[model samples]
Every structure is written in structure tokens, then in C-alpha cells.
Target chain A: MIPIILFLAPALAMALFIFRSKKLNAVVICLYSFTHLACSVTLLVHPASYGRYFQVEPLNLFFLVVLSVVLAGISVYNADFTLKSAVPARKSTYYSAAVLVFSAAISGVVLGANLGMMWVCLETTTITGAYLIYYKTGKEPLEAAWKYMFICSIGIAFAFVGLIFLSLAFTGSQPSLFFTDINAHAPVFNKFWLKMSFVFMAIGFGTKAGLAPVHTWLPDAYSEAPSPVSALLSAALLNSELLIIIRILKIMKIADLGGFASAFLITMGVLSVFVAAVYIIRVGNYKRMLAYSSIENMGLITISAAIGGPAAFAAVLHIAAHAFSKASLFMTSGNILKRYYTREINGVTGLLKADPKAGWSWIAGFILLCGIPPSPIFLSEFIMIRTMFGRGMWWLAVPVMLLVTIVIYGMASTMFKMSFGNPQKGISQERFNILNYAGQFVFIAVLCLLGIYMPKAISDLITAAASLM
Target chain B: MTEVLIAIFGITMLYVSSTSRVEAYIRVLAVQGVILFLMVLLDHAHLEVLNLVFLGAETLLFKAIIIPVFLMFTVRKNNIQREAEPFMPSFYSVLITTAIFAFGFLIAFWASSNASNVRPLYFGVSIATIITGLFIIISRKKIITHVMGYIMIENGIFMLAMSVVGEMPMIVNLGVLLDLFAAIYLLGLFVTKINSTFDELHIDSLTNLRD
Candidate 1:
């Protein structure tokens, strides 16, 4: 029943959109989002109702749940955002419908039992995401949308070729692309083809994951996109891309190619963080700053997850912590953008004095993002650092800590300057709307709660999900 | 017959590499599409009726007919100048493309040494075509030409997928076709949108959002 609703709801939304029943869209969005979250929570106990094409196992269970949670928050936020924004009626309807499609596609990417199905779902996310990125349709948005569309599509297309190469590793007439089956028989697959396949996919899926070398489209898309879309892309879409890469890396693990995959992963991971570190300081726009931070966090996740053991557990915690915090920050940045009409760091001033809720949320989000104490990111980073030492990876620890420090300092200095200054003349205080800050506050509260006291069940789930590596 | 179709398919990349005219590129894409449909049909002569229909729709209807027509419409509608205005000289592009093709054959020779279910010629040609498609993208300046490069890469990838005898599930095949269609369709839409928004349809105009 859950899977049915999950799959059918998008089509229903599209139908409604086509019929011009754009009213009640906010309620429709909220109802469908609850169904999505409920379905993910339900799948924690029961396997998916649709088992052939989509499956739910421990590896994907937590990812699915996090996606739903982040998306649910985004959905609530988007409902408020759409209702209040001065966007024309038809445009808002299209936005709502596109969001539904994007939701389904990301869900599909998480639940795909077959590798090919995952590839398809991953590409669909790009198409829908481009729409959201291009929502404003101005010069910057158009350019961002174009680059995002071209690069990611070409990346996924190469991934499809990689899929074919993976099939070539098998000698049979019909190669099974089932994820579990591939993982099981990975040892027997041809090493040459498997290595080739991984190279293509690393470049391919890495583009989506915001890894260095292929991460150029990310900052543009993130900054140009409406805040909610940025939230969704950072929180949900990236995790889905990482899920597939994690599965592929598992194949490498089973095939005795763990070192190769890990070396490749760490290189990209380090480079991503290094790149983000360099750019975060030099970048002028605050939203692009958030985008670079996402790249850095993704780098951190990949590095620790590659290291395995307790660090992998920490990585999962980091994924959740980063998702909600980044979502909060980006959306709050939207609030900041609306208040000031500028994304430039120097252009806007006195955020705290003007709108206290958004201002505080912005600072809290920055705190969580930079891994301050009492934020779950602090706990995750602590575990990663401990594992780095215990495993005799003291060399990796230096760069990791250094780049992390750079990132925090860069973001913190910008955040403080924006938060503390006096407002420019002609600034008017808009009516306080709880919806704008509601999702962000809730996420911050959850992260704080997790940091102070991690629940046993949630810990168990993260542990189990981490063990799949 | 299969080798001949594949040979003509590989040769199409040579023309695309050497040509600067957008109309010629569109025609060559159409030719490659027909050749792909023929090659796939020949490879899987004993396929089921359902599979045959899908292959025909994906390769013949969409790839050959619809996509070419759409590209043509975009070209005419945008009033784009005929020259693709590639970043490199045509002579250099032809040389590089040929070298890449030679490299592909060398790889095929090496890969054939292993025990695998691959058609060496088909595999080699498709790899070269894919590389050449990428080369076209990097060496070209026009956004429309970039879309052509994307379409070429798709064709090359499709051919590569078909080169091996292994069968992906029909559902995945459907997914691939649908995605390809949506991507190209969206590319067409954006080409028109970008064309109107900017003075020239060149990639240089797209540098506004860079960090």
C-alpha cells in the first residue's frame, strides 16, 4: 500500500496540475509528503511491497528514511514558500508538479533493486532538478540550469555505458543487474572490466555527488536555484547518488579491489574538500558558500565512509546532520535573500536585527554545518578523528582537520559579518511567518537532540547501515 | 551485413568530425540512427515481437525520425548560422578524431585477446564514436552543437550496449529510451530558450554563473 501510494501519487499530482487544479496544492503536497515519510518509516520493518523493481534492505533503509525526512521538511517549507511568493499561478503549479516528480525520482534512486533502474532514476532526478534550478529563468538561473543539465546528463549517459561495461564482465547471454546478485558474485567478475566500469561510474556518478573535477555545475545550481530546491538537492538528491556509488564500491570490496576503490575515493574526497576550502573563502555569494560547504561535507562523508568501521557509522550520522543543517541554512538564506534582495555577502547587513527567527536559524545552521559542539556534526567529526588515529591514519587526519578548519573559519567569518552588522537604509521588516523558519528550527532541534543523547534504535539503525560497507 | 552497418556507422563519425555545417551534422545523426536500427535488428533477428516494437520505436521512430526532425526545427527556428564554429580548426579535429579511432581499434585488438562476449569491430567503432562525440563537445562552441555531441554520445553508447550479446532487461531498456528521449527533448526546449535569451547561441554567453 505504501509503495503504491508512493509511485501513484506523482502521476496524480501531474494530472491535477494538468487539469489546472493548482489550488489546494499546498495541502496536496503536505499529504503526499506524509505518505512518503510514512512509507519510508514503514519500510524499516517490512520490505517494499513492490519487490521486483524496488527493494528495501538494511543498506538502503536508513537512506530512504533520511530522504523522506528531509523531503518532508522541504515539502512543508515549499508549501509555505509557494503560497506566499509572488510567483504566477501557472508557474507555481508547474513547480509543485515538478517537485512531486523530483520526489518520486529520488525515492526511486534509493529503492531501485536493479542497477539499471537506479541509473534511470538518477537521470530523472537531473531533469526534474534542472526545472527547479531554472525556476527563476533569469540570466544566472538559465546559465546554471544549462550547465547543470548538460554536465549531469552526459555524466549519467557515461554511467549507462559503464553499466554496459559491467555487463561485459559477465560471460552469460543475460547478465543479472540485480544489486544483491552483483554483490554476491562480484568476486568472479572480470577484474579488467570491473575496473573500467568503476572509472566510468566514478566520473559519472561523482558529478552528481559533487566530487571534485566534475563538481563545477554544483555551486551554480545550488546558488541559482530557489532555496527549497537547493535544500532538496543538497539534502536528498546527493544522498541518492552516494547510495549508488556506495553499492558499486561494495562490489569492488567483494572483488578484492577495495584498495583501488578506496584510493580513488579518498583522492576525490580530499580534492573535493580542498577545492571547497579554497573556494569557500574566495566566493563572494553566501549561497555559493553554502554550496561549497556541501561539497566539503560530501567529501568528509566519502572519506570517512571509505575508511570503514566506526568512521562509516560516523559518516551516516554526518549525512543526516549535514542534510538537515544545510537544508536549514539554504532555506534561511532564501529568507535572507527575500529580506535583502541580494545574495552577495557584503550587500546584506544586520540579519539578526531585522528578522530574529531567520537570523538565529541562519547562525544555528552555520554552527551545525561547521561542526560546533552540541551539533551532531561535532559528534560525527569526533568519531571520524578518533577512528583516524586508532587506525594509524594520522597522516590523513592533518589534511582533514586542516581543510575542515579552513571551511569552518571561512563560513564562520562570513556568517558573523552578515549576522551582526547594521541594516542598510530602506530595509523594511516583513511580517513574521513561522512557516519559513519552522522546518529549519525543527531540524536544528533534532540535530541538537541527537548530539546530546542518541536514541538506541537510531544508533542501531546507523550502525547497521554503516556495516554494509 | 552487421559489420558493414557498423562500418558505415563508424564512418559517420568521420563526417561529423570534419563537418562544420549544422545541417550536415543533423543529417549525419539521422544516418547514424538508421544504421543503428539496422544493426540492432540484424543482431537480434530472433527477438520477440514486443522487443522488436521497442527497438523500432526507440531507434527508428524517435532516434532517426523524431530527434532529427526536432534538431532540424531547432536549427531553423533559432536562425543559427550554419557554421558550428568549433573551437579547433577542422583539419586538426579530423586528425584527432582519426587518431582516437585508431586507438579504439588497438583497444579492440587487445580486448579480443580476453575471453568475453564482445564483437571487437562493433565495440571498437562505438568506443571511437563516443570519444569523437566528446571531442566534438569540447571542441565546439555552439550550444546547439553541444546538444548534437550529446546525441552522438547517446548513439555511440547505444551501439556499445548492443555490441555485446548480453541482454539487459527490457525494463531497463525502456528506461534508457525514455530517459534519452526526455534529455533530448529538454535539450531542444532549452536550445530555444537560450537562443532567445542571449544574443548568440554560443557557449561563451553561459559564463555568467561561474564562481
Candidate 2:
């Protein structure tokens, strides 16, 4: 019953938007967000119920909570952001509808018990997200949307090929693609087909997760998308894609193929950090810089999962923390864009004087992103490094630490320049609605609170989620 | 009979690789759809009536009729050039695609010798088609060509799925068909938007949003 409502809330919102009532857009969105958050929380407390195609497990519950929280934040920010922006009423309604569908699709991805259903849901997110990215259609946004749709569709098609290969891995009986059924039969599965499936799934879903080599569309889409939508893309969407990878990794572990899966993850992780470092140093657009930062964090999460044990625990924590902090950073960046009207880093300066609320938020968000002390990322990275030492992976730790340091330096230096300087001409001085800061403050407060002390119940939830991984 | 259809499907990929006209690509896609439809009909003997009807609609109506007509409409409405304008020459593209086909046959041969469950011809031709589709995307400069490449990949996947048709549930098959239709429709919409915004459909014009 709860699951049906969870899915229906957004579907109902999308249906309402078809009527094109501009005034009710915000109300419908807010109502859906609250309902989603409440449903996620209820499921978290009592997760026994099941749907035919979807289920609420520990790992999915954690992800659902993170998605709902970030989505709720985005909704709050969207309420004010929409009224102030120049989007026409019809487009705004369309944007709201797309966002609702996007959320519903991702919710489906996380909750789906069947791999094929997950693939379908993930593909739906791509289509809906492209719509959201093209919300304010122009040359740049349209290009970003095109690349996002085309590249991701091709990648996901490869994943479907991988699913076929996965089906091929089974013998003596027809294979079922339900998660539990696959896990039960994984030991007898053909290793060759399994490896092939993993590679295809990695590249396919990796494109969606913004991992390296296939991560080109990410920065473009992130930079061109409206700020609230960017927040969702960076904060929520990438994690949903990673959840699929983690699910596959579990099957690999059960098949005694954990080493093979870990090796691929470690390689992609290191490569992503290296890629992020290279782009971060020479980045021209601040929004693009944040996109690269997201790549770096996702890479770290992959590394943490690859390292296993306590590191997996840290990885789940980092996902939650990064969701809040990154969403905050993106929301604040939207505020900066609203003031400066340019994504170019050098185009605007003296953010401190221009808008102190956005500036401080930007600085705090960057610090949190860089894994500074009191940011949950700091603890996650620290645990991952310790796991490396305990596992005698000194060779891996050295490069990982070095690349992380380079990324930190690159982002901090760039952020410092943007946050503290003389106010440039042509910057808008309009009074921002206090609601604009409301979401960022909530995200920041959550990050700081988690870093300082995690409640016992939440810690238990994180531990249970990690154990499943 | 199934092998003959699969062989014909494989041959159409070569035609796709060697063609410069967008219309030729669409025609080949329609042919591939028809071949796939025949293959499905030949292979499945005891499928329920509903599943057969669904598969028929997906392959015949959506893949063969709806998609090609949609692409033709898009090409006409956008006034895109008739030529695909690939980065590589057609002869070289054909050469590479043939090489991929041979390589796929080699893999199929090796797999069949070692495993009884593997369907060598289906695996070989489908993989060859997929690789050729990716090659088309990489070697082409036009956005419309890329869409065609994507469609070719989808067709390849459909062939692969058909190789083990009885194993996958009806829901999964329907989901895959629905996703393919949605992806192609959305891609067509984007191509039209790109044509209007950039006033050109070339992939090179899309470099404005880069880092």
C-alpha cells in the first residue's frame, strides 16, 4: 500500500500538470515532496511490506531517504526560484511535470527488485532528465540535452546487451532476473558471461553515474541545467545509478567473483579521480568545476566500496553526506548564477560583497565537498585510507591520496577566488527571497550535524545498509 | 530458416555501413525490423497469443513502420541534408564493419566449440551488428546519423534478446520495447530541436557547452 502511494504521488502530480494549471504547480510539487519524504520515512521504520516489482530493503531505504531529503530541499528551493526566474508559465508547468516524473523514475530505480525493471526505470530517468535539462531551451541547453540523451541512451543500450549476456550466464534452467533469484543461481553462472555483463553494465550505467571515459555529458548537462535541477542531477541521480552498480557487485560477491569486480571498480575509481583532477585544475566554468567535483566524489565512493569492510560503511555515509553538501553547493551556485548571469569563473568576483549569504554558503559547500574536517566526506576518506593500509594496499592508497589532494587544491583555489574579490560590474543587486537560503541552510545543518555526531538509529541504518553491500 | 533471416539481418548492417544517404539507413532499419519480426515468428512456437501480438506490434508497427516514418518526417521537417556526411569514407567504413563481422564470427566459433548452450550465429551476428552500429556513430558527423546508429544498436540488442526469447519474462520484453520506442522518439525530438536551435544538424555544432 505504501509503495503504491509512493509511486502514485509523483504520477498523480504529473497528471495534474497535464491540465497546465500554472498557479498549482508549486502546490502540487510541494505536496508530492512531502508525501515522498513521509513515505520514505515510514518505509524506513517498517520495511516488511513488498510490492510485486519493488521492495524496500536496507540499502534502498538509505538511498530513498537521501533522495527524498535532497528532493525536498530542491522543492523548497524551486518554490522561490521559479517565481523569480523568467520561465513562462507553460514551460514552468512542463518543468514541474518533468521533475515529478524524474523523481518517480529514480524512486523506481532504487526500489525495483528486478534488474530489468530497474533498467526500464533508469531509462525513464534519462528521458525525463533530458526534458528537465532542456527546460529553458537555447543553443547550449539543447546541445547538453542532446548529448545527455544520445550518449546515455547508447550506453544504456549496451547495458541491455549486458542484461542479455547475464541471462546467458545461466544454464540447466531458464534464468530469472529478479535480484534474489540471480543471487541464488550466481554460483553456477558462467564466469565469462558474467564478466562480459559486468563490463557492459559498468559502461552503460557508468555513463549515468558520471564515471570517467563516459562522463563527458555530465559536466555539460550539469552546467546547462537550471540550478534546482542541477542539484537533483548531481545529488540524487548519480547515487541512484551507483546503487545499480552496488547491486551487481553484491551478485559478484556471492558468486565468488568479488575480486574481479573490485579490480574494475578500483581502476574506474582511480581513473575518475585522475580525470577530475585534470579538469578541476584548468576549469573555466565554476558550475563545471562542481560537476567535476561530483565525479571525484563518486570515484571515492566506488573506491570505498571496492576496499570493502569498514570502507563500505564509509561509502554509504559519504553518499548521504555528499548528497546534502553537493545539493547545497549546486543550489548556492544557482543563486550565484542568478546574480552573475554567467557560469564563467572570471566573469564575476567579490561574491562576499555582492551577496554574503550565497558567498558564505558557497564557501561552506566547497569546504564540505573538499572533505574538510567536520564534513562527513572527511571521515569517509579517512576510513577508506585506513582500510587501504589495513588491507596492505599501500600502492593504491598513495595515488588515491595524491589525486585527492590535487583535486582539493584545485577546487579550493578556484572557490577562494570566486568567493572573495571586488564586486564586478553588471552583477544584479536584487533582493533574494529568504526562502532561497532555506534549503542550503537545511543541507548545511545536516552535513555539520552528521559530521559532529550521528544518531544511533541512523548509524544502525547505515551499518545495516553497508552490511548488505 | 532462422539462420537465413539472421544472415539477412547481418547483411543489412553492411549496407548501413556503406551508405551515405540517410534515407538508405532508414530503409535498412525497416528491413532489419521486418527480418527481426520474421525471426521472432519463426523461433517462438508456443508463445501465448498476447505475447505474440505484443511482439508483433513492437517489431512490425513500432520498429518497422512507426520509427522509419518518424525519421523521414524529421528529416523532411528539419530539411537535413540527404547525405549522412560520415567522418570516414564509405569504403573504409564497410571494410571496418566486415572486419568486425569476421571478428564476431571468430568469437562465436570459439564459444560454440566450448559451450553447448551458446547460440553461435545469433551471438556472432548480433555482436557484429552492435559493433557496426557503434562504428557508425563514431564515424558519422551528423546528429541524424548518430540516431540511426543508436537504432542499429537497439536492433542488435533485440536480436540478442531473441536468441534466448523463452528465458526472459513477458514484462521485461515489454519494458525493453517500450524503452526503445521512448528513446528513439525522444532522440527524434532532440534532433528537431537541435536543427532549429543551431540551424544545422551537424554534431560539431554541439561543442558549445564543453568544459
Best by TM-score: 2
Per-residue lDDT of candidate 1, residues B135-178 (tens digit): 99999999888988988888888778776533554533644475
The docking quality of candidate 1, as DockQ, is 0.58
Per-residue CA lDDT of model 2 for B57-130, tens digit only, reads 78898789888898898889888889899888989989999999999999888877756777899999989999
Query: How far is A429's C-alpha from truth in model 1 (Å)?
Result: 1.1
Against the unseen true structure, what C-alpha lDDT does each candidate score? 0.85, 0.86
For model 2 chain A, give the 10-residue run with minimal summed lDDT.
A1-10
Q: Which ten residues in a row have the lowest lDDT in candidate 1 chain B?
A: B165-174
Model 2 residue B84 CA deviation in Å: 1.7
Error of 2 at A413 (Å): 1.0
lDDT score for candidate 1 against the true structure: 0.85
Clashing pairs in 2: A350-A421
Kindly report which residue pairs in candidate 1 clash with one another.
none
Question: Predicted candidate 2: interface RMSD?
Answer: 1.9
iRMS values in order, in angstroms? 2.1, 1.9
lDDT of 1 at A467: 91
